[model samples]
Target: MDFSALNKSAANSFNQQKSLIKKVLAGKKVKCNNCNTLISVHTGADSVMIKCEKDCTDIKLDAELLK
Candidate 1:
């Protein structure tokens, strides 16, 4: 997604979310949607997919971070 249109506040929020995710995950495997558990991280990827632990829905990170 093109995030260039996001305002300064929104961009800041997005960055903050990314930072939080990095801190939380901390180089460990995470769960995915559709019951596929323990998905590993892809190195240097701009986007990361995180499954909702409570609802089992695939949430697209970085793009939705600014929304």
Candidate 2:
């Protein structure tokens, strides 16, 4: 995965939402609503809604990292 782009996007999206990011990062686990996959919420931003590159169905947003 091109984390550079993800990180960039997350940073931009969470520019003013530092608290959100912190909350997400504080947790060790996160889940993908579309794929039901568990992802780790580490750095960058919280619940950064990203499009699924594998199968672009409906817009999949990260639910773990939200306000």
Candidate 3:
């Protein structure tokens, strides 16, 4: 199997995902530290889960960061 092609495909997917996420967050909202996507707000006990939209990676952000 050609690993180069696989790597290139993965890289292209990553780049596309990154660009899409960046375009969505171009308004300058708070970003998650783990995956670098815009932060999300949930309605529950915690009320907030900072996950990257592309990868769903979790990030621990401080409340003060919202300010």
- Displacement of residue 16 (Cα, Å) in model 2 is 15
| Candidate structures ordered by lDDT, highest first | 3, 1, 2
What TM-score, computed on C-alpha atoms, does each candidate reach? 0.30, 0.26, 0.28
RMSD, every candidate, angstroms? 9.1, 10.9, 9.4
List runs of model 3 lying over 4 Å from the truth.
26-67
- Candidate 2 at residue 60, lDDT? 36
Assess each prediction's global lDDT (C-alpha) against the native: 0.53, 0.47, 0.53
Clashes of each: 0, 1, 0
Residue 35, candidate 2: alpha-carbon lDDT = 75
Give the TM-score ranking, best first.
1, 3, 2
Task: Pull out the clashing pairs in model 2.
Answer: 47-65
Q: Which candidate model has the greater TM-score, 1 or 2?
A: 1
Residue-pair clash count for candidate 1 = 0
lDDT of 3 by residue, 22-54 (tens): 543354465555567665543234333345676
Better of 1 and 2 by lDDT: 1
Weakest ten-residue segment in model 1 by summed lDDT: 36-45
Model 1 accuracy (lDDT, Cα) = 0.53
| Maximum-lDDT candidate | 3
Question: What are the per-residue Cα lDDT tens digits for candidate 1 across 1-67?
Answer: 5557567657766775465456445865545435655544332356656544544544366644434
